[model samples]
Target chain A: MTLHIVSKSPYSSSALADCLRTCGNGDAIVLIEDGVYAAQTGSEKLQDFAGKAVFCLRADAEARGVAVTATVDEIDEARWVALCTEYRPIVSWFK
Target chain B: MKFTLVVYGAPHASEGAASALRFARALLEAGHSLYRVFFYGDGVHNGSALAAPPQDEQDLLGQWQRLQQAHNLDLVVCIAAAQRRGLLSESEASRLEKSAANLATGFTLAGLGQLAEAAAVCERVVTFGG
Candidate 1:
């Protein structure tokens, strides 16, 4: 499984959308930086990630004042590192 | 696991570079070997020797240099990207007839073939961008 890291905002870039187009089964997505905005409550962007593992960097979400939705797990830096170890061919979507 | 990181954001301009730095530190602490940190796009600016941010702001390039010194890290900046951004090494400056060199102490200018080799050998390849 691949770990797809999205660091751009859904509103500003096609990074998340582009990533989803190529994302396969059992892949996980981690939202970082402005990308955490997609995890905000009531965001329609979350629907695009349906049935896929999703996470948001806790520090990034808090710094951006975003209250991450219930479905997305908030992860610390250590967890991020662990995810890297778990995934093969980790990809970053930053546009 | 051995890993390679591709950085595409310049320090302070985007959070990606800072996040990459934190991740690099954590990976080391977790006993993972960093095969290389390849700087592409604006990431090449991280190797600029002339950056002088205010004292209040973080000296990100300096931090990278320190980490490189401490660990003997392989910080390679993409040659094509570095030249386009005017980030020249001493040899490059002389070759290109530029005014002076601005590449920092620890970073080396190389080609995309290095990235290809890294991806082929490293267990994992991650990217950080803004």
Candidate 2:
């Protein structure tokens, strides 16, 4: 499984949408940095990632004072590291 | 495991370059072979030989050069990206009629194909960006 990391905000960049378009089954998505913004409540982008293994970095969410919705799991740094190990070719999508 | 690192942020303006440098060091320490360090987008700025950071600050460009020298690392700057950012190799500068070249020592301007080749062979491809 490839760990696709998105670090750009959907509001400002198309990295998230582009990443989703190329991502396949069994692939995991980790939202970090400004990417956590996409997991916020009422975001239209969240719907596209439903049923996928989606995670957001808690530190980024808290730092931005964003309340992530239920669709995504909030992960700490340790979990992030674990995901890196569990996945291969961690791909980062940025603007 | 062999790895390829894609860096897409400027050295002085973002944490991406520094973070990538640290990660590269750790990978080498762990005995993993690095296939290449591909600089894309603003990451090409890391290859600017004209960078003159304060004496008190860590010289990131110099550190990268030293690392490349020690490991015989393949440091590649995307030629298209470098051209857009005014980072020219000696030949590119002459071809473009630029007065001087600013690509740092130990770095070569190459096509995106290098990145693809690295990805094809490396066990993992990690990216660092702003």
Candidate 3:
């Protein structure tokens, strides 16, 4: 298992693309920092990975003021730690 | 489990390197081992030996050097990217007729095969970028 952290905005960075191409099931993608931009409501790119678990860091989302109502989970730093510890993922792609 | 860290951001440009460094330290603290840290694209800048930060500030380059020294970490900078960016080693600098070379002490110049090998060897491959 592995967790991919997408730290760049979706429109410009190929982070999401790399994650989709290389990541397998039982993996996760966390949108943090500028990556939260990809989690906004109605993100077309996110549609493809609807089956994968998508998470956004609450701190980054609140700081960036990105409004979203997607079916994704908003996770805090504590949860982030928990996710890293729990999954112990095999790969994390950031862009 | 062993982990591989790929850095695709330059030092002092964004929070990517700092964040990755912090996460690497944390992973080590958690008793995890790092297989390698691959620097590619703009990330090759992290190995530039010319960086000189203010005395009062935390020199990130020095931080990486210290971290690698302490942990015996594998710091691999892409040869293609480094050459393109003019980040030459002593030998490359001399061969290319450059006056100086400043790639960091701990980092090595390797090919993409290192990245592929890292993927094959490591249990986790985490990337840090812009």
Candidate topping TM-score: 1
lDDT of 1 by residue, B24-59 (tens): 998888889999999999999998999999999989
Sum up the clashes in candidate 2: 0
lDDT of 1 at A61: 96
Give lDDT tens digits, candidate 3, residues A1-95.
77788887778878778778877888888887788888887778767666898888877788888875467799866566457766765354554
Looking at candidate 2 chain A, the ten consecutive residues that score lowest on lDDT are A76-85
How good is the docking of model 1, as DockQ? Answer: 0.82
Best model number under DockQ: 1
TM-score of 1: 0.95
Candidates 1 onward: DockQ, in order = 0.82, 0.30, 0.32
Docking quality class, candidate 2: acceptable
Please report, as a value between 0 and 1, the fraction of native contacts recovered by candidate 2.
Answer: 0.45
Candidate 3 lDDT by residue in tens digits, B1-130: 6878888888878768887787788778777898899998989999988888889976888999999999999999999999999899998889889998988899999999999999889866777774
What would the per-residue lDDT of candidate 1 be over residues A1-95, giving only the tens digit for each residue? Answer: 89999999999999999999999999999999999999999999989978999999999999989999999999998899999999887888987
Order of models, best TM-score first: 1, 3, 2
Candidate 1 chain B: worst-modelled 10 consecutive residues by lDDT = B10-19
lDDT of 2 at B31: 70
TM-score of each: 0.95, 0.69, 0.73
Task: Give lDDT per model, in order.
Answer: 0.92, 0.89, 0.82
lDDT of 1 at A7: 92
Per-residue C-alpha lDDT of model 2 across residues B3-42, encoded as one tens digit per residue: 8999998987776787578668877876778889999999
